[model samples]
Target: MTEALSLVPTTDARVARAIDLIWREADLLDRREYRAWDELYADDALYVIPIDRETDDFASVLNMVYDDTRMRRMRINRLTEGYAIAAVDAARTVRTVSRFVPLAVSDDEVTVRSAQILVAYKRDHHDLWAADVEHVVRLGADGDRIVRKVIRLVDSEAAVPAAGFLL
Candidate 1:
């Protein structure tokens, strides 16, 4: 049997606050609130999906995405545009978050890593699908407000089916 895991430790107040934000972010995504999801990013923020490979060389392999604010907006646009089939089936998925940890904490930034499990139920065409994923998020400063979020998804590239929707 598999043993249970624990969350990351944090003594910093910023880390605690950031963890809350991260949780809220995950909740928003699971709830399919893309508009709120878009609001969470810093203007110059980046959202990256590095392509999974057998090798450890990230720079050499292609990343599924490395989106800046504009690109992220485009992503939101495409999903809400109603032309994407995945989005049609998207509202049926639910993702659960756990084992959230603060890997690194700084005065102006925080990096968090968390475990996610998503279970999706589509119509009669597809059976239920599920996956376990890890996210590495980088939070940075944008003036008085905090901005910037970079997420790395750790999963088997081939195993992923229609993550057409951002994780």
Candidate 2:
């Protein structure tokens, strides 16, 4: 995949900014900085993980996870407040994001597509997960904010380990 995406240059300033934002978000999530990570999203942001890898029509098809701002707030609250036991004991994660391609760019919005490899480590155990990640970021006077994030897991149809933390 990386080789296939080599045609797209990563030197553009806008692309650099978008990639930086993505890396920051990943770092925050990996550190379990829920509040800080939540702040990266726009008020109307949507976070989605489709159950079927071939489809992204969340309204018509069931999704593994579909979250709006309210749902995201609840999720973050649970994780931070210790109400979610799985999250409280979730493994640490290190994510590598690559193949960043600018799908669309405008004065107020930037859409980027990338490949990700996430490694989760727990006591004497670890899991490796891969996915294609899309992020629609809205640029505001304040800064860049995430408007939508879609994650297509490579093994969506297979039984997978618990994903208590944000992908």
User: Which residue window of length 10 is worst by lDDT in model 2?
Assistant: 1-10
* Candidate no. 1 TM-score: 0.72
Task: Give Cα-based local distance difference scores for all models.
Answer: 0.59, 0.85
In model 1, the runs with Cα more than 4 Å from the true position are 1-8, 53-60, 124-154
Locate the minimum summed-lDDT window of 10 residues in model 1: 1-10
Candidate 2 deviant stretches above 4 angstroms:
1-8
Mind giving the per-residue lDDT tens digits that candidate 1 earns over 64-108? 776778888888888788888877656365666666666655556
Candidate 1 residue pairs that clash = none
Model 2: lDDT to the true structure: 0.85
lDDT of 2 by residue, 1-167 (tens): 12223444567666677778999999998899989999999998999988788876786888888999999999899888887779889998999999888887666777889999999998889899899999988877889899999999999878889777889
